[model samples]
Target: MAVPNAASHLDFVVDPEHPDAEPFYAPSKRNYPQAVKGFYRSIKWAALVATLATYYLLPFVRWNRGPGAPGQAVLLDLADRRFYFFFVEIWPQEAYYVAGLLVLAALVLFMMNALAGRVWCGYLCPQTVWTDLFFAVERRFEGDLHARRAREAKGWTFDRAWRLVAKHATWVLIAWWTGGAWVLYFSDAPTLVRALATLQAPAIAYVWIGILTFTTYALAGHMREQVCVYMCPWPRIQAALTDEWALNVTYRTDRGEPRLSLKKSHAARSRGEPAGDCVDCRQCVAVCPTGVDIRDGLQLGCIQCGLCIDACDAVMSKVGRPARLIAYDTDMNVARRAEGKPALRRLVRPRTILYAVAIAAVGSLMLWRLTTRPGGALAIAHDRNPLSVTLADGSIQNGYSALVINRDAAPRTFDLSASGVPGAKLVVEGAPSDGTRVRIQVPGDDTREVRVLLRAAAPSGAATSVPVTFTVVNETSGETATATDRFETPAAN
Candidate 1:
């Protein structure tokens, strides 16, 4: 919260010795965005409430996934290296899903960018929502931007001091809860909440909560627009991704230019001279979160949140002028209007089509894989150093490491057998081995790796390597999975 004192304001003095020298960066200034009410503001409020509610309350929703599995609807079971989302279970080996999800998210963001520039930053970003809430808290405690600015100019009094403290205290509380809710997704939410309340939760949980709390407070409460301006990369990305035709928060210079006072405009109009609607009021700049002046043409600072549009619309209403002088329109359209051409919108452009197609393809593929994947799986890796050994009975043996997965509600007994090798026999260490196959019992929703040895008499003569498939059959459900490896025979000298 680098709220510099008025006394600390710098004097820009030019040096006689190095006359061409200039400051590389300007000094940071405080931005006090005033509240505005209009269509866009209402939309922002709705989005804030909905996103915050989903973030804070989603962990409480429970889902029954049978015994021995967590009931939390969304959980990352680190101990078991499993991820549960309602009925969907993702094993550690299925981490590709996370990568696929990231790709899908990027495509969706691109689609949004194509539709409307930086709309995600304006409405749906966590930073914007939390910062909006924090601003509301500030306004509640310290009054709107005007009062706060006046109070600061007059120097801090006892009431102002208390208000500042109260505002920050509320911000910290909200941030703490934000962080606390995040940890609930890793474990049972209700149980964790009880543990946290009683100070019985793990130390790591408290550490994470504290870290997130501090960051949230610093970023949302203190930094605010600076995060979107100096820190975020989305603005730069949006700049590259956007075109002249992409819709953005723009000031219609044609409609609002020739800036004049209301009385001057009236006088000019009566004299049959040209006059513009704009009264040179700074309402649009006063309401922007990123402190961007949309009238200065498109800049990197604007998040396209449309608060400026709302502010301009409110100003237009008060002045009895038509609304939307500041609007979500394209720069190309603005130029077209300046050139006496009608504005045209083409939403279904090539870039947008590409993004939509990519999103749909990836989403459909993920859904199909999720729904059609097998319940059980197996894999085998054969030993290299000692590929085969000739026993006293002239039998050939090969060692292997076998991994079996059990995606079931209850424990299962799996019978392991080898095929594609004549007279081959399977033997699993530490498991019941019969003359035909080896039987191993595995717990539900788990994977086990075991040492296995296969012995089969020489087919006719010594063969170098022969393809063999190891099959594991679930005795209860009769579900089976197989993996292939080489069954080696001793080479002839």
Candidate 2:
């Protein structure tokens, strides 16, 4: 049997005699999604506006990050090797925060999938948002589905040609702006805008913008649902991750099966025959961006966007039937309803709870680390060659390198000292010594490497190595950091 509401390209026949024969392949057809209006549609519109506004306008939002720091609120300062998001600054060495963020995002995605299948792909994904915007632009220029199809059937006319030209031009313009907005995160937005406008931006920036423009145009304007259907991996992944309890854009077979037209259904009811609420109007298929028939059940092509819900609701209302014939539902609920049992909604099941707990744990750890981390750090490395030199005064001097990091905004003077070696005297290169400790100064938000020497009388033993602790105490804040390395001495000769 032919697939219900199948696209033109998919409407092909296989020989009944040769059941295993491959079906003829046809090129995919272009989709003209009809305009929809409903609760879910309103949600999508709000999400589109909020997301696009944040994307295009956030770079211009400024933050007062001191005099020397970049003022952009959210920036990836490659030159300085820093990621600044509002008050949070990430150094290259502290890359675990980024990893934690990615983990948190993945957990949240899993949780969303566990709660509602492919909700992210439907509402929040960049492809969906841009394609929705593109569709709006297309409707503005080329009219709705019927008008566009009618115009296409009439061959080339001035009306169709002008509309096509205008639509494509607007699509390209939107794609260009999308690309332009992306590059703003890497630099000061106002300055980069001026440079881009005057053609003074770096060649690499222009190259990236051009590449992004081409991709955005191809994916959103032309590819549209093809990207979701073929290119994206999320559908396959979510299929594996989703359980029967996960709510999806499901056609209620219990309510919609044995479908008939409105007039036929009325006559059948008069004859005391059973008839489903579905009128077989196919509005759900018409408004689908991916041209999927939700009544065929949960297929990979169903993005759970709920446009079909909106479309089916409209149709049901017109026929004076109850809404939600196509709705966010579950296979388990469908089976229960089919068995003449009440539907069950297990939104707070084990999998969802696990995902939520993981998200909260990771998010909390990252926040705690970000807020409570120290403003200074220390690292020490013992010299490999000539590990220790025996001076004429019978003192063993161990050469070492110490890196002092100051994460604060002001310069700090740290007192460097050594312990675990009796009678040890610290000597720092290019630093003043106060008999016991050496004073080293590190610039604000920078690291300073200094050569250090630990001189002490060898203990009266055959011990060739001694454990030594290196400590740096910030003079202003009394904050301290420590590193440990072994001090070596020659075996007794």
Residue 89 CA error for candidate 1 (Å)? Answer: 1.5
Q: What is the alpha-carbon lDDT for the whole of candidate 2?
A: 0.89
Q: Give the per-residue lDDT digits (tens) of candidate 1, residues 315-369.
A: 8888899999989999789989999999999898899889989999999999998
CA RMSD (A), model 1: 4.0
Tell me, what's the RMSD of every candidate? 4.0, 4.7
What TM value does model 1 have?
Answer: 0.88
TM-score of 2: 0.87
Each candidate structure's count of clashing pairs: 0, 0
Candidate 1 ranges with C-alpha deviation above 4 Å: 1-27, 381-399, 417-425, 433-437, 454-470, 484-493
Residue-wise lDDT of candidate 2 within 290-401, one digit each (tens)?
9899888788888889999999999989988999999898889988898899989999999999998999899999999899877887889989888888999989888998
Cα RMSD of predicted structure 2:
4.7
Best by lDDT: 2
Query: Deviation in angstroms for 293 in model 1?
Result: 0.5
Error of 2 at 197 (Å): 1.6
